[model samples]
Target: MKFQAEACTTSVGGPRWERRLAIERRRAENHARRGRRTFRLSRIFSLKTAVKLFLKLSRLQARGEANARRPIIRRVSFSFPNLPTSFDGFRILHLSDFHFDGEAARAVMIRDMLRGVESDLCVLTGDYLADYFDPLGRVYCNLATVLSGVRAQYGTVGILGNNDHSEFVQRFSDLGVRMLVNDGFELGIKGESIWIAGVDDPNTFECEDVAGAMRGASSGAFKLLLAHSPEVAREAVEADVHLYVCGHTHGGQMCVPVLGPLFLNASCPRRFGSGAWRYKTMQGYTTTGLGTSAIPARFNCPPEAAIIELRRAR
Candidate 1:
């Protein structure tokens, strides 16, 4: 009787142990499947993200190339009733946002476009290099070559942009581009002087000092301010700047046909993103600029070099 009971217990225990093993094995297999599924989902997500980013970048590049190929010149006329008679009919070639980078071909294209363009003075509002943060030596050389074609009687005067660095101020100066960092330059025509006061980039570096730049400006002198961003136009108005030139906003870089600038990337009104406007008594002009920013391409809004003809209003 004892042997039979022992045999029965062994049989029952053996089946129970096998059943437990089977249950655990199924759970392990299920866990493995879940882990594999999770990994695949994660990989797919990462791949999708990378592809999206690449596609967006490519699109911008395409747009940039297209804009570069078809360079446009905007001939604009501004009548300043208060403008000095000496500066009347004074034509300024306003070129801004020359974030020069990429292939040498781009520089060649710029040279071809500016072949016959003429101006009494050339004013580069800022952003000579496309990305100062990149390996900069090449960018510097590119700038010199690209701007070589730009000609003016009084030469080129520049102000720093948000993307610019402290070192570039001197570098640009060396290239015959007078970079004014909260400084002033006096232009004398037949003993009459016109003050060109420039402030550093007002947005990115926040180094602009309107009062400091205008320190030596004579009372009631023809004072013109060169600013990087039009965001500071209001401040210039308060400071009694007669004319303010800027170019940080790429005229909404990529604009929608009917809706206009989709992203102005500026604090001022969308209208100020490009073209001429007035802030109180101050006349302000913002350039669509010559090159793209953030990305290398543009859409709808083509790259342009602005020719501003200053006329004394009747």
Candidate 2:
């Protein structure tokens, strides 16, 4: 039997081969350069930026985020003993925990929802941006569309939450929303007055000053406190606040049937963490909120913008 012998090219040193090798080398060099550049960036970056980058790159925005576009309006009314008779039936539109973080449809929904809403006052309780993914200072670019035409006779007031950067106060203020940082405002309505105060974020960063916010307001005066987290509820009530409003819990955004709250990052009691509850004489309300956080999808709990009416107790 005769076997055929096969010939193979042993010299890959031809001009064409040389050109191919050169191209391969360039690709390797580029890959190495990119890795080095990323290393340098990691070295100079703070933990915050690193975490944000990781979350943005690796996090999966869950489905049903579009459900976030249609928010329900929660209308709750309660009587306050000290609420002025003339101010009875005064309505407050509470918009909190927006978690805007650049979701266009949700932003547009907020804008449309408020178009037909009329209130004596408006309050924004924080978590303005979902996380660090959104570029700093751009949170309001879309929020302005929602807030511009909101009908509030007194004005809109805002406070920062754990998810917010300190500089956001001025940004919201620039958009005509009165941003209160550990401060108080005495608002007169119908010849009577109520004290509205806001505290800095106390849930994650712990910079709140409730006593400071209560300054200048009388002990017997009807007071409302705006906070980003219900964690501040105890502090506000201790400061002689008559009522408190906050968000951040998202009403257990995702809850198990009877077990409830897949996870609640807040320290407030579970019952008082979501809707209306009272501590001593102080009434507190926490909204499920208008948007989502971490993951855009919410299960069991639907998004909401709340309208709370204040009336005098008989």
Off by over 4 Å in 1: 1-64
Q: Cα miss at 290, model 2 (Å)?
A: 1.0
C-alpha lDDT of residue 253 in model 1: 72
For residues 94-211, could you state the per-residue lDDT of candidate 1 as single tens digits? 8888777655777777777887888888888888777644546765677777677876777777777866655676666667777777778677766667788878777765657787
Each prediction's TM-score against the native?
0.79, 0.78
Q: Which run of 10 residues does model 1 get worst, by summed lDDT?
A: 1-10
The Cα RMSD in angstroms, rounded to one decimal, for candidate 1 relative to the true structure is 24.9
- The Cα error of candidate 1 at residue 217, in Å, is 1.2
User: Which ten contiguous residues of candidate 2 have the minimum total lDDT?
Assistant: 1-10
Identify the candidate with maximal lDDT: 2
Superposed Cα deviation of residue 121, candidate 2 (Å):
0.6
